[model samples]
Target: MITIAKPGLLTSVQDLGRYGYQKFGVITSGVMDPVAHRVANLLVGNDEKEATLELTLLGPDMEFSEDTLISICGGNLSPTIDGKSVKLWRSVWVKAGSRLRFGGCKTGCRAYLAVAGGFEVPEVMNSKSTYIRAGIGGFNGKALQNEDELEIGTPSELSANISKILADQIEDKKFAEMQWTISSEFTVSSASKPDVRVMKGRQYDWFTTDSQMKLFTEPFEVTSQSDRMGYRLKGPELSLEEEQEMLSEAVSFGTIQVPSEGNPIVLLADRQTTGGYPKIGQIATVDLSIMAQLKPGDTVQFVEVSHKVAQQLYLDREKKIHQLKQGISLKIRK
Candidate 1:
């Protein structure tokens, strides 16, 4: 059990997300950085889809009512347990009554905390994710706040074994003794601020040739009005050859919409189900996780790639995750 001492800017419980309801105009609300969120769960021996706390730019301060194992991943937020600093992308054991605190992030926007057995929240629409806009799912359909108590699910056999092993291995009484680091190999590396790969959209030809060329070559700054919904970009205004009303249609995550103002708005995880604006491009799924971490005023550039290549990249990523899970299971058996 855990109690929130301070709920930062925005913090909520989330799992993989609610799917198969897009036909009903519901957008999937899940962990923005699926990779990081999964890794945190892996460290704590939780299923990848297990519910965990998703902390935004700022994070929460919490106190544990019981001894528990937790793993933190995504973002470079300085976290501390019982007043001692701990590392991100690592698992640590907190004794009963220990306080966990997080400072503002230095690089990324969201951070994930995967407790052993995962956070147990009521599922709505078959999802434990909190969709704030809809006022449904997770902790009474809202963000966590001070004095809120959270319950954790029953621990899996793997988690039980791992916790016992961890307790025996660490001999020191200090906080460092409880720390366990996750491999950095799984972390994404961007060439610049954020290297986002995109595919030209159906309406790509509507823009003048020069405008299309500039989009690929120029750097765009993220406007302060960015959130989980979409990112507004500031760059050279695009000119359309023939401006006409667009029909509202199903839009997927990462769709870059060009409104009448000519500025692009990149739809994100919690974006609307349909949009009528012209889509200039669509960022690859793998790259969308990287884009989710960018803060306001951050610079980003788009590189064009084929849809086939994007699909292949996504499959490869899933394969890697599957292999990692298998490897961890094998280690537990030994």
Candidate 2:
């Protein structure tokens, strides 16, 4: 078990997301950065979709009840054990009675913390993701609050082996981190201004010629109003060449919808099942990690890419993830 002495910003337990019920009006609420969540689980020898603590811009101050093997990935929130920095993207062994604190965020907006086995939380709708708006899943159906004590699940054999190796070295130190780490190839870029690729939306041609041109050339600033539902951008006001009444259609993550207000809204993990707004574009899946890391006030320039290119990029990313899994399996036995 772990005790949250101080719950910073918004800490929540999340797996991949609740799926298959979107048609029934349930939104897919999950980790903003899927890659980070998977990586964190992999480091601790858990299944890819196991639950992890999704620490937002700020992190929590927690105390462990027992020594555990853990991993921290995604954003760099400067996590430390007993005032000593713990490296990201690798396995770490934390001793019981140790205190964990996070300093100011150096890059990225969120971090995923995974312990051996995984956080023990009840599943709702076959997923552990917390939809705060509906209060359906996760810890009591809400973000972690102060004084929350979460139970830890039983670890797998691989996790126990890894912990044994680190336990031998942590005879005195409060924590110990493994030497090797996952490559930065999958790390989300924390650049204030970044080029995000997207595929033309279904109604791309309906937009005025100038608006279409600006969509790729102009920059948009992410407003503070953004949340898990969507990122409302401020930049050029876009309008269709002619207004037309349209039926509501299904929307997925990264759907860039242009409403009457003209500004673009990038629907994210917590987006609604259907939308009536005209979609200007769909962000390339490969760059969703970069989008997830963008904080308020960050500016993003859209880069147009063909659907073919987008698919290839996604395939390449999955290949890397597969290789990482295989590498970890071999390394653990040594």
Candidate 3:
């Protein structure tokens, strides 16, 4: 169990996302950065889909009520246990009663915290994600606050074994992180403006040729109004070839829809099930992690890629993750 001492800005629980209910108009709420979320779980011997605490631009302060095995990934928010800095992308064994805290942001816009056993949050619609707007799922269906206590779920055999090994190295009386860690080379560092790869959307041709060129050339700034729902981007106005009435259609994560206002809205994890806006592009699965790291005021340029190349890039990423998963399991077994 753990108790929150300070709830930072917009901290919530998430997994991969809720599925099979989008036809019912349910919003898909989940971690903005899938790579970070998955890697954190893998480091702690949890299944990739297990729920993790998704920390936004800011994080939370909590005290552990029991010995815990955990890992932090993605954004670097300067996490410390008992005032000592902890390393990102590594496994950590924290002593019971220790206080964990965080400071200002360092890189990226979000981070993920995964424990050996997932958070003991109630699952709604088969997912533990917290959709705060609808007030469903996650620790009592809302963001964590000061004084809130969260129960830890039972750890798997692998998780227990890993913790048992780390326990022997805990001479500091508070916490100790493993020496080796996942390489940071694979992660997207949000230190500068990034170019996101995208494929033309199904409704791509509906936009004027100049607007299409502008998408790949003009830099777009993420607006402050953005959230998990969508990124409201500011750039050269995208105009349609001509006004045409269209029925509401299904929208997917990373759908870049150009509304009548000319600005594009890139739908994300919390996007609505259907939209009537014309989609000019779809972010490639490979670059979604890059897009997820973007924060308000960050600038981004779009790069066009063929769907075939995008699929290959996704395959390569999956292959790498598969290899890493096997490597971790083997290391733990030894």
lDDT, candidate 3, at 306: 95
Which residue pairs collide in model 1, if any?
none
lDDT of 2 by residue, 43-147 (tens): 999989999999988999999999988999999999999888989999999989999999888888889999998988899999999999888899999999999
lDDT of 1 by residue, 1-334 (tens): 9999999988999888899898998889888888889988997889889988989988999998887888888876778886778777765766777888998677678889999998888888899999998888888889998899999888888888777776776565433233435456566443356778999987888998987987788888899989888999999897788887789998888999899998999998788999999988999987887888887888898899899999999999889888888877777678
RMSD of each: 1.8, 1.0, 1.1
Backbone clash numbers for all candidates listed: 0, 0, 0
lDDT of 3 by residue, 154-218 (tens): 99888887898799999867998787887665565755878899999988999999999999998
Error of 2 at 14 (Å): 0.8
CA lDDT of each prediction against the hidden true structure: 0.83, 0.91, 0.91
Off by over 4 Å in 2: none
TM-score of 2: 0.98
* Cα displacement (Å) at residue 133, model 1: 1.6
Q: Each prediction's TM-score against the native?
A: 0.95, 0.98, 0.97
